[model samples]
Target: MTFAFPRAVLEQHTAFLGKTGSGKTSTAKLAVEQILAANPAARVCVLDPIKSDWWGMTSSADGQRPGLPFYILGGPRGHVALHDSAGKAIGELVATGDLPLSIIDMADFNAGGLQKFFNDFAPALMKRMRGVVYLVIEEAHEFAPKERAGIGAENLAIHNAKKLATAGRSKGIRLMVVTQRTQALHNAVLGSCDTMIAHRLTAPADQDPVKKWLKSNVDKMTFERVSSSLASLKTGSGWLCSGEAQVADLVQFPKISTFDNSATPTDGDAELHVQTAPVDRDRLRAIIGDAVKLAEENDVPRLRAEIIRLNAELASSGASQTVAAPQEEIDAAYQEGLWTGCIPSWTCSRT
Candidate 1:
């Protein structure tokens, strides 16, 4: 199953929407996998507020081989437990340091805590990011709601998300928002994405926005066919609506090379799949070195254990470890990769 869209979407904003169990995460991971493979120095940061198991990114498809190198933050599988107030420090680390694929698991947070964390994190990340970064926010509506009644916390969260959507591009933050509740996602945020990979969405309000976009951007037949088929689209299959590329495709995204941790588990599945692709601890340190230091400055006790753990890893890593290319070279390659990420699946034609 191969899916194609504008290759340049790597540098822009994207929205993945559908109902639950409709393959939104699968397609999102497909793009992330492609980006990492297409660009070796690729840096990705994911905010999984739902606390989903993103650690699978480091594992191979069969869970037998070492997968991509990833930094796990504040979860059951985390290198260090997350401190609630360390959001700014964490944000600054990702902004300044060179990172592999990293997931900030904020499942421990309540709504207020979640907003407070992003309140500092999102702005700092948007401000200090150096090289190109792809920011994936899963369950985006939880961050930027159309109308969530709360104190200033919810409002700030929504505003920050909108800022990421509107102003993040200049600072090299390519945002990919994943959500099942398109009806609840803010209009500004949803409308900002030029590429929309839609999965099964049966709700009328959810379909309304796609319909409106299709009405003006696509031809009448395309609008009708796509809008009518949303209710019946099969799992792991849907439409790719990119008005700019002029492609409204019926697509089944390619299978991910990594484990599908997002897949819902069946009954009696007691064996936890914490297994990830083999990890390089020294490489992981290169990404989290500054973060550990920041923890020390703030006197976060949990990270002391991490510092000791990493020291052992560094000593054991030995001479087999390799040095990465210089930052300037990596940046150049990233810019070049932006134009070629989806080239393998791409085609040019006039409708």
Candidate 2:
């Protein structure tokens, strides 16, 4: 059965909890797609540690909507460094309305890098938000673990995330946290959510938190029935519970309208084909101009240093010794829908 959420309800904090292979990502994607479809001005930021799971949001195949902007902070295709400046640049990009939907692939970063990026990005994003923004965190437990110890960076990240969960709503930053292991997530973050879309979960560790949270809203008999139903749910089927029973239901998601780029890769599917389209020159120019402007306005020393280093490298290589023709040429080429030189902090591919 299909379930639709109003804009008001969509803006509230939500959680997607289930075991692996239980369709948490797919359901979350569908919810995001619908949110964007219903509100053209809405913005979404996905923290995808898997790097490839959210590509469908940027895929423009037969049934998919036009692709969204893509940013790779630390992944196989990453171009942006994991420095604080780069993190802030991304936050500024989002805060300044430069990106509509941004998927940050974090698969390549080490634990330390991941923690630093998250700690830096959340505050920057909250600082300049002018409109409502949805922040989707996949593998939520990694960012906000239940147990704290010698992991300083992770603990810092968790602290920042908890702050966002508790206080970000006034700033128009909402969260959609996806996790396979509910027991491992920080209680503060989980407790902040008023809506939960839960799929099959048999582990007592996982079930207990859900039951504990629902007990206050659902009667004992209904809770038992819902608990049993949750344990036996098939893939793509789950219970959608809001703060109370009157607004909840069992939902069965239909086939997603976009390409499943996140599908598990098998031996036979090793060499898949992806469609590409011509880049939009005006959009590319606007993005570049905004990024440069934000970098200057934010006084990001690392970005400035990186730019200087790149210019020096170009000069020393004699490719643009006279007047740094490499960057100039790159800009000219991009204006003509061609990409040259190394990847920038953010890159857009048409498909």
Candidate 3:
């Protein structure tokens, strides 16, 4: 069955869980494609441990027109210095709407380096952008583990991830975490997700968390039925559960128009060669410069004042000022000049 995700849910937290070869990555990419396709102004940043998977989006294998202009950071030969000012500048550029869809491939770095990179970049990006940006973390279990005992820099990375998980929504930084091991993932990160898309999962470790999360809306009998049916789920099929939708259902994802660069390589397959392109730094700077000019022309100070007033009203009512209000109210506010031009429409109202 077709499952339609609301715009509110798209701008919130989402998780995709499944075993290897169960289509977790594909499903996550499908969600990203859907979001960007539905909203041209929307942007996404993918953190891929393997650099090759998302290259298809940058350029087609068959030499056709590319899907999106992706600026990639780090690769097989070397990594971007994430802790340095140059690295922070990249984050700032993205935060300021310079890069539309950026990919940070961690294949070049070891565990320690990857941890440092996340610790440095996550907060920087959060500080720069308010919202309308989607950060997709592939293999999330490695970055935010349930037990961060002795990984050195990884501990700090986990802390940074947890902080972002809890507070990033208010700033419009939405996370889409994809992982094969559900139990190994950090509890804080999983608990923060508003939506869960689960594929075939047979192991009790993985099934337990999904079962527990689903228990809120699904009865024991119905849950058992659904659990039993999960074994029969094929690739690209799963259940979509979220508070935004009234009922969860077994759903099959539609085929993506772009190439699946993340496809698993088969034995005896010929070696594939592809060239990596550098990011257009000049163009990115110009984009950010134009954005700043637009904000100035739109009277950002007045917009900020209106946002502060709205936030105070929400807080006095004992509701989260960061959470969106109802869509109707936001629409009315926009008409009445109560809405701010800076905030995203999705976060304008609680859905």
Candidate 4:
């Protein structure tokens, strides 16, 4: 049965973590596409670091009723190129900076070359956001590892994302961080999400994080065994956890029908071949431009700066920034901090 998302928490942000060939990317793409198709005003931004199979749609930016878009970054020849709807080359953006600091708030931490993209590109795109802005990230551990517990850009990003997950719902920003190793993700990232999608991860160690993240709501052994059993689930079959076990169930995607029937060769009737059109470059550029424009109008830079400063401050407190606190308490602390800024000397410390 299909599950419905709560309107109050309508901005759906999901984390699909699974090993290679587990179909996390394909599943995310399907869900986002469905969201866009259902809502004409909807838009999405994807941070594709590896330029995986999803790159095929990069050239079709100009077509489709609500055209889909794509942008290609790392590939052979060591240069980043932006393609348009017609598969035509447009221009290239510099690929430089520390990788860790690229996407999150680094505060001069280990932010490799990716810093250039996040600081230069991401801010611009987030501004023009319209209906919904979903962030689809794979290999998330590279940015947010479990072992290192300190202040960094990756940590900052996680912090800000969690904040957004809790409060950005009304602001129209949604995030979906996909990874094969669930344990590697920060608790803040997982905690912010209302829904968690698990694929065929067979290890108990990997599933341990979810157990801790979900608390007594889910048992470690049961989740591990359930996820491990996914090998038998038809290609697209998987489960959705929304805090209630009675609602979650295995689901399968319908076979994709293409315009050119001849293009699809006859195969085993059981295995449906779903064709995801190549990434659309022109559309991507347009979406990025639109998102950037929205962010600009809504003071995205200022908001990000606020988040950056708050993150840095929290990092200095000598406590885990991902520490789970009640919403009321968090708001109280924020209020106290604001009041402290107004009142010259009295600072309230966490009790």
Best by TM-score: 1
| CA-only RMSD, every prediction | 15.9, 9.2, 19.6, 18.6
Candidate numbers sorted by lDDT from highest down: 1, 2, 3, 4
State the C-alpha lDDT per candidate.
0.74, 0.70, 0.69, 0.46
TM-score of 1: 0.78
Q: What is the lDDT of residue 20 in candidate 4?
A: 62
Tens-digit lDDT string for candidate 3 (24-109): 78777778777877886888888776544665555444425455567655453221212111335556666777666887776655
Give per-residue CA lDDT, model 2, range 103-201, as digits (tens).
777665444556767887888888877788889999998889898655548878888889889998888888999999899999999899878888999
lDDT by residue (1-351, candidate 1, tens digit) is 355446776668888989998988888888888888788788899888875657767777766666777777766566555644567777877787555467888776544767878888998887788888889999999889998968448988999999999988888888899999998999889888877888999999999987876777688998899998999989988888876676888897777778766663523252254456555666665556665444334332332344445545655887322232234433443532322221221221211
* Pairs in clash, predicted candidate 1: 58-277, 59-276, 59-277, 66-278, 67-277
Model 2 has an lDDT value of 0.70
lDDT of 4 at 23: 61
Determine the backbone clash count of candidate 2: 0
Q: What are the per-residue Cα lDDT tens digits for candidate 4 across 1-351? A: 554433322356677755565666666666655665567445454555443433323222222222243333333211133211111111112111111101121122113433234433443333433444556655666545665545335544554445544665555667777777787777767676666666665567767765554444456665665555654544545566555332344556442211222222335431133332454445444533543333233332343355456656777997545433334433543642322231212232444
Candidate 1: what lDDT? 0.74
Candidate 3, number of clashes: 6
lDDT assessment of candidate 3: 0.69
